[model samples]
Target: MAEFLGYENFLVAADGAVRTVRPEHLRVLPGLGEHDGEPGSCDGLTLEGVVVDVAFRGVDRVVTVDADDATGTTVRLTADVRDSALTASPGDRILLRADAAHVVALAG
Candidate 1:
């Protein structure tokens, strides 16, 4: 993941320019594991959602999650079935995880 994070300390100049405070480093991960966060890194993204449906894709199943934070805010994402216990059905709780997700800044 470090390989993906090119900048060490991202900063913006008064003129609206981005810069890094340090040098660059390269790293890699073999695979993304379940439960635990990213390998050798603590960064992970988890969101709560309700399983809307699941479709079988060969040996694995693609689960569709519908997330609503009330206030009319909603988001959706797809995930692979974690285990046999997770079945394709509506109203199931979904813990959408992005073990490889990284934080990025957006102009407000």
Candidate 2:
């Protein structure tokens, strides 16, 4: 079982259904405001979404995803070496860390 440490109260079922496991769920992370700081750091939050686009560079990979949250924010993810080669396509469900900073997509 992969435990989302920072999001102990936020759980998503295997069928993509989201539910609040606890009443204080939303208060787990309080520093993720839109303008509080930079993006890309998952220190205080976790995000789940579907991959909307993907591009690969020499040894780097970039992914564009639309989060399932109400903000409807589009986030770009930089893949680690292993993740960079994973077979990801549009609409593939994924779980990512919030506060992601560098949202740059790789050039095709």
Model 1 C-alpha lDDT per residue in residues 1-108, reported as the tens digit of each score: 433764332333233433222211112111224435445334533445676777777776666666543233564545555366554476766455443234233243
The prediction achieving the highest TM-score against the true structure is 1
Off by over 4 Å in 2: 1-43, 69-85, 98-108
What local distance difference test score does each model get? 0.45, 0.42
**Once all C-alphas are superposed, what RMSD does model 1 give against the true structure?**
11.6
What TM-score do all the candidates reach, one by one?
0.46, 0.39
Q: What residue runs in model 1 are displaced by over 4 Å at the alpha carbon?
A: 1-42, 68-72, 101-108
User: Per-residue lDDT of 1-108 in model 2, one digit per residue for the tens?
Assistant: 213432233333333444332212211121224433445454534665667776665665555555544344343333332343366677777655433232222222
Error of 1 at 65 (Å): 0.3
Worst 10 residues of 1 by lDDT: 22-31
**Deviation of model 2 at 7, angstroms:** 25
